[model samples]
Target chain A: MAEIVLNALAHTYSRKPNAPQDYAIRQMNQVWEQGGAYALLGPSGCGKSTLLNIISGLLEPSDGEILFDGVKVNSLPPEERNIAQVFQFPVIYDTMTVFDNLAFPLRNMKTPAHLIQSKVHEIADILELSPLLHKKAKNLTADEKQKVSMGRGLVRDNVSAILFDEPLTVIDPQLKWKLRRKLKQIHDQFNITMIYVTHDQLEAATFADKIAVMYEGQIVQFGSPHELFENPKHTFVGYFIGSPGMNFMNVQLEEQHFVFEDMKLKVPEKILDKIQHLPYESIKLGIRPEFVHVWDKKNDEAYEVDVIDSEDLGTYHIMTFKLRNQLLKARLHEDQRIPKHKAWISFPDQWLKVYVNEYLVEADDE
Target chain B: MNKIENNKAWFLVLPVFVLVAFSAIIPLMTVVNYSVQDVFDTNTRYFVGTEWFKAILNDAALQSALMKQFMFSFTTLSIEIPLGIGIALLMPKRGMAASLCLVLIALPLLIPLNVVGTIWQIFTRSDIGLMGWSLREMGVAYNISRNPVDAWATIILMDVWHWTPLIALLCYSGLRSIPEAYYQAARIDRASRWAIFRYIQLPKLTNVLIIGILLRFMDSFMIYAEPFVLTGGGPGSSTTFLSQALTTMAIGQFDVGPAAAFSIIYFLIILAVSWVFYTTIMNMQKEK
Candidate 1:
């Protein structure tokens, strides 16, 4: 296994692309540490697959050198790179038995027959496909075929990494957890650098120790799920990384206080100090719904707004309330009283975030 | 839930049955009628009862022609199927080049059979034809007449040139339907080019190849025009296929009874062989 690095990597489907919008992957540099589980998370059409293909050497980057273990491998094909990829859909040899499907990579390496047999058996056992070893891969279910596809990746001995391109998309929801757990177990066992690309935040968060949140062909933030939820590096990250996402609204500085359409939010001096020089129209205030506290109405520091709606979700409720002319969300615990017409909510200074020009302005005592 | 039974649905299908009766059933019945009767005229006829069938089956000339027919069909299939697949694999997947390739491959298939026969006849003639002239210049005695082996070779070559495109087109469509993920996975697996073809491409091609094999087999088995135009069963009747023999008997000699029996046997052979082959290949797929 080796650390993967993308050096000034960029890609454009057009031969003479001149505009940034023409790029499928914009110029950027990143490193994936050896033996680390990482997720490249993004929405559909945000170049997640394009980036994954570049990593696996399926698509050559229009600009950049991809280094494996500090060796420039920009021209090497996937076969020479020793990278294995499991695609979005199951891609196993249909005419082969599950055993042969799993054994394919090993056989390709000209590995001994006995070793291939044991390796395939080990992988099949891990994938819960031992019973189907003799059955044709085409005869198996979609999920089973996907497992066989993954099993092939696991069968090889010298693979530098395994890339998964939304490998769980076609799986039944119940089996998703099982397969993810199996992937975790394999990561622990093999210590291969696994880069899983997906659009689902839950899938990414659970699978990777760190996730690179992509927006418009660039990775806007790369951090742990907790860091992403608490301190999003970009407005898009705040808008993408959590359930119901973070609450954000444009803010204007009026002498000392941050104001938005007569509604005011108390901004920390440190946050204000960093964003003071930025353009006024570019300023934005953000806070996660979980951090928006619903307090007692008798408290004067809290803003009491009329409740627009509250969606009951078993263990918690998402309370939407109107403050002056702006609506905001606050996640409330199941044990908390469900406010009917009005709710008093307060934004904590520590949880509040400042943004200038769509990127987070860090004001923490770092 | 109680199912709603509607007999009126079959009324919607009555047209198809009527069409089949007029197109296939009545014509086949007439052939059967002629096969079992000795008829000088419509009014003067006698029940022959297997007499024509026995004569057709036992005739040494017809038996040799049947053997030649099998050889021709088998040769053409063996050459065309692999060649078509090869051409398809070499073809580009998409773009202007791919579209151009598709149009050119489809050109041969769009030609009428009669025109194709005429084209090949003149094209392979010993004197005036390009192929014939080129071969003569190269010191190879290439004549579709006067030499049995040369006639057989020319006819087989012409059949391949005319018909291989159908197989290629079918294979190209089949290859296109396979997702790009397969090739990606194959590459990631470090599969050799041969391995990719053997395990991935070939397996995916089985369905289309079955169609290719069946269509080519039937057409080549019943081949008449091209060879009839090129050689006319010449060179001591060495290349006289079953259809030519049947044509001589039915039209030239006016032996309608024997020709009818021969036609029935020919139809049965094609049907039985195609069914057996299709089932065998399908079962092989299932086992895999």
Candidate 2:
């Protein structure tokens, strides 16, 4: 186990990346401390898998230095790097028994039969696959096959890190939870540095200590789940993380205040000062759907909007309101009163996030 | 919950049934009829009651031919399977090169068996042929007509040259069907090249290999044309296989009853061996 550092890592499928879009993974530097669990989180085709493959040495970065324990391993093969990767679909040797499948890596290193047996038994017991030891890997169900793949990774003691590229994509929803918990338990037990790649925010939040949010082939933000929720470093993160996500409204700094359409949104003085200095022409105001307080009366600091649609989502309600052709969503709790066609809404100053050119501008916390 | 009996569907199957009966059953019955009786003429025949089968089984020339047939089939399979896999592995996977290699490798298979034998016959002539002249230039005695060993070697090589491409093409398709994820996983597992072959490539090729083996075994066991054209059962019947023996008995010698029995035996052997290969390979897959 070793700390993994990617220094200005970039990958381009094309020999000559003429434009920024040509790069599958744009230039970025990141680090994973030894034994840290990180989720490379993004939507599909956002380069999470590309980054994961680069880290596992499955795909060498077109440019960059990958250092393990401060030693350059950029040119190392996956085998030499001692990295294990579990793919989106379960990959198992179809002709081998589950025991042999689990014993594969150890046997590859020519480990003695007795040692392999013990290791196989241990991993099988941990994965609850002891009963399936004699069964062919091809005969197992999807999750069981996935467990076998994981067992192959876990069988080897010298593996520096285990990279998972959306390993749960094919598993059923019921089994996804159990398998994810099993993976978490295995991480705690093995203390191997694990990087889990996924597009599901819930899976990322539940499985990883830190979630690296990727957008457009770049890691826009890296932080703990709580930090990502409270203060997303990029507007994409704010829009991607939560249920219904954070609602963003296009705004312009005019004269002294921020104007969204004809409504002048009230912002904290410190934020207003930062907004004045923002060099971008386009500005946006972001707030989580939960933070937009809906009111029955047209109170001070409240802006009037027409309710377009309201969905009753069991425990809470998500009400979509239109303010001068701009749609805004406010999540209301079960006890909160449902508004009529016309409703007055206000985004609390504490939850107000200012964005310049889609990147978060530091907001003053209440 | 009553089930409907579809008696009308039988009418729909009548056309195919009649076609199969005319094309297959009638000829097969004629062969059976010939096998069971000794016919002096169409009107006068004696019911032999397995006498022809017994006589043909005891025939030493037919026995030797059967042995030769088995030897040829087994030897060709053993050589071709691994050689085909190797060639397939070396074949380019995609793009223009792959297409070119496929066309080139398949060229030999497309030629008629007789033409292939004739081409090799002229090509192996020491006086005028490239391969034979090259061997002669190298001072090695390589004559197909003069020595049994040389004839057998040449026949086997000709068969390899003609049919190994079929196996290789099947294996190429099999290898192409395998997803890239398996290789990636193997690499991550630190699998040796041999281990990758043994575990990933070999197991994935099982289905296609079974088809290749079955087709090759049946086709080789019924070998007639190529050897007939090239060797002509030459150098003391060294290459006279089952089909040639059956041909001699039925056509050359005019022993209808015995030839019909031998034909049944040959058909049974091919059927039995094909069944065995199919069941054994399929069972191996299911068991594992």
Candidate 3:
């Protein structure tokens, strides 16, 4: 296994990318440490697959260098790179038995027959496919076919990394969890660098130690799941990573105070002191719906808002509110009372994050 | 769930049944009637009771024609299947060049069968044809009308030129239907080029290859028009095929009893061979 490093890697489908939209993958520089489980998380068409393809050497980057273990391998083809990839759809040789499908890579390398058998048996046992060894690959279920695809990767002797591009999209929901657990078990046993790409946050959080959030062909934030939920580096990350997402409102900074329409919000003294040194005019305040505390009585630092709608989601109620012309959502517990027309909500100081130009801004920053 | 049982839906199928009967079954019954009788004329006929069938089976001319017919079908299929696959492999995968190559390859398939024969007849003529005149100028004696080898070669070449495109087109569509991910996965698996072809491309092309082979076999077995126009079964009976012999007996000589028996035998051979091809290929796929 090797530590994969992307040094200023960028790719564009067009020969000449005159604008940012023309680029499928904007410039990126990141390192995937050896034996680390990482997730490249994004919505559809946000260049996650393009990035995965580039990393696997399926698509050469337009401008950059890829280094495996600090060796420049930018011009190397996928076969020479020793990188295995599982695709979104299950890909298996339909005419081959499941045993032969798992033995394919080893057989291609001209490995001895006995060695190939052992490797095949090992992977099949791990994937719970031992009983299907002699069956034709085409007759298997969708998830079993996917298991064979992954088994092809695991059967190899020297794969530097295994890249997965939403490998669970075709699997039944109940089977997806079992397959994901198998993947984790494989990662623990093999100790190879694994990069999983997906749009589902739960899948990413459950699989990878670190999640790289991509938006508009750029990785806006890379951190653990806890960090992504608590202190998002970009507004997109905050909005993308949560169930209800972080609620953000456009605010203006006036004489060391934050103003949103007619509601005035109090800022901490340290944040207020740092506000004078802000570099941008556009400002926003963000807080997770789970952190928005609602009260029926007027309390200190509370603002009144009209309740537009409320939905009881069994475990929690998602209450929608309107302040001036902006809509806000708050999540309440099952035992919590639902206020009538008007409700007072409080944004805790620690939970409130300030954004300057759609990027997170720290109070301690210069 | 309760099942709905209704007999009225059969009325919708009656139209197709009537069409099949009028087009196929009725004509076949007439042939059966003729095969079992000695028809001297419409008014004068006698029951032959398989006499014509036994005589036609023992006829030396019909036996040789049947041999020639099998040889021709086998020769053309052996040449065209490999040649068409090669052309498909060399063809471009995408963009304007792929479209241009497709159109060029499909040009000969659009030509009428009789027109193709006439074109080749002129093309192989010694007097005014480009290929024939050039071969003579190069000191090669090539005359389809006189020499059996030259006649056989020319007919095979003509059949190849006229029908190789059908196999190529079927194979091209089959190749296009394979998703791009298979190739990528093969590359990542470090499979050799030949390995990719053997496991991926060849397996995926199995269905189309079956269709191509069976179509070529059945068509070439019943081949007429082209060879009839080109050689007129010339020099000797060397190039006379089963269809030409059947045509001479039925239409030229008006031997309706023997011709009807020969037609039934021809239909049975085609049906048996096609069924064999289909079942063998399908079983091979399942076994793998």
TM-score of chain B of each: 0.93, 0.95, 0.94
Local accuracy of candidate 1 as per-residue lDDT tens digits, B174-212: 999889899999989888899999988998999899988
DockQ result, candidate 2: 0.77
Candidate 2 backbone collisions, by pair? none
Pairs of residues at least 3 apart in sequence or in different chains that clash in candidate 3: none
What is each candidate's DockQ, to 2 decimals? Answer: 0.74, 0.77, 0.74
Question: What docking class should model 3 receive?
Answer: medium
Q: What is the TM-score of each candidate against the true structure?
A: 0.95, 0.96, 0.96
* Candidate 3 DockQ vs. native: 0.74
Badly placed stretches (over 4 Å) of model 3 are A269-281, B1-17
Report every candidate's CA lDDT.
0.89, 0.91, 0.92
Residue runs of model 2 more than 4 Å from their true location after superposition = A275-277, A363-366, B1-9
User: What class would a CAPRI assessor give candidate 2's docking?
Assistant: medium
RMSD of each: 2.3, 1.8, 2.3
Consecutive 10-residue window with the lowest summed lDDT within model 1 chain A: A272-281
RMSD over all Cα atoms, model 1: 2.3
